[model samples]
Target: LLGIARFKALSSLRKKKEDWIDDDDAAQVPDSADTPEVVTMKEDKAAALRRFVDALPEEHRTVIDLAYYHGQSVTEIGEVLGIPVATVKTRMFYARKKLGEALKAAGYDRGWP
Candidate 1:
């Protein structure tokens, strides 16, 4: 179920490439302008990051989802998961390390968003 959902989300992201904008480029676009290469680069980085996050181990991914996606603090995550706060912090640390390594290896080592 999760895989299917992720696939659908990624497919939609690819289809709606122009909707993927950084904060600096959020202004309305003129119809006369061509789609810039920078847009493609942003999409590439987004796709790469998504792929890496999805490929993470379940434990690591859960920590990432709770902390980043759901905006949970370490203490909050620990409470929700019925684990110690220290454990939550450790999982987050390892998850971030793995994600950083994966993103760097995919040639998106700099300028995140």
Candidate 2:
């Protein structure tokens, strides 16, 4: 029940494009600098990341979404999910490892720009 509510809230938040990038970070990018190629590349990277994250197991994905997308700390996530703090940390560690491997496999070896 709680999980369902949390998932719904996160899903709604995720649907907002403005939530994807921080205001300060967005301000750093000049409108004039977004050449078509750069825009396409950025889109591709975002698509790839979304695909990879979506592929994660539900438990792992939940931890990642709460931590990154919602900017929640490990202790906060543990409380929200009713899991132990160590379990949350473990899930985050494995989630990050899997994401890194997926990105590398997808040819983002040098990491995101």
Candidate 3:
């Protein structure tokens, strides 16, 4: 029963996330009222990054989504995907490197924290 309930909750959250993706107006904005210039620049960068991530190979994209979107740890992603933890780590590493290179090619100069 508990497992079923958890699944239902996760399903609902997934649906909401999908809806947010489909609706650009649903994106969260800063409360401090960012200037139009800053907002446009940020949006452009975000769109570029998203395109890069979407272009990743399936395995790398899966790891990236599970880690960042679903907020799963390396071990958790491995368990969910039925892969070894080392594989998860490797996918993440490669995904990040690919994304970094793509972003650089897109002229994104901001350093990662």
Model 2 misplacement above 4 A: 1-34
* Backbone clash total, candidate 2: 0
Off by over 4 Å in 3: 1-33
Q: Give a tens-digit lDDT track for model 1, residues 1-113.
A: 99999999999988985556876676655566436876787788888887888999998899898988899998999999999999988988998899899887877766744
lDDT of residue 19 for candidate 2: 40
Clashes of each: 0, 0, 0
Arranged by TM-score, best first: 3, 2, 1
Candidate topping TM-score: 3
Give all TM-scores, in the order shown: 0.63, 0.65, 0.66
- Write the residue-wise lDDT of candidate 2 on 1-113 in tens digits: 99999999999988977548889999998777678887888889888888998999999999999998899999999999999999999999999899999989989863544
Clashing pairs in 1: none
Query: Model 2: clashing residue pairs?
Result: none
Model 3 / residue 90 / CA error / Å = 0.8
The lDDT for every candidate, in the order shown, is: 0.84, 0.89, 0.86
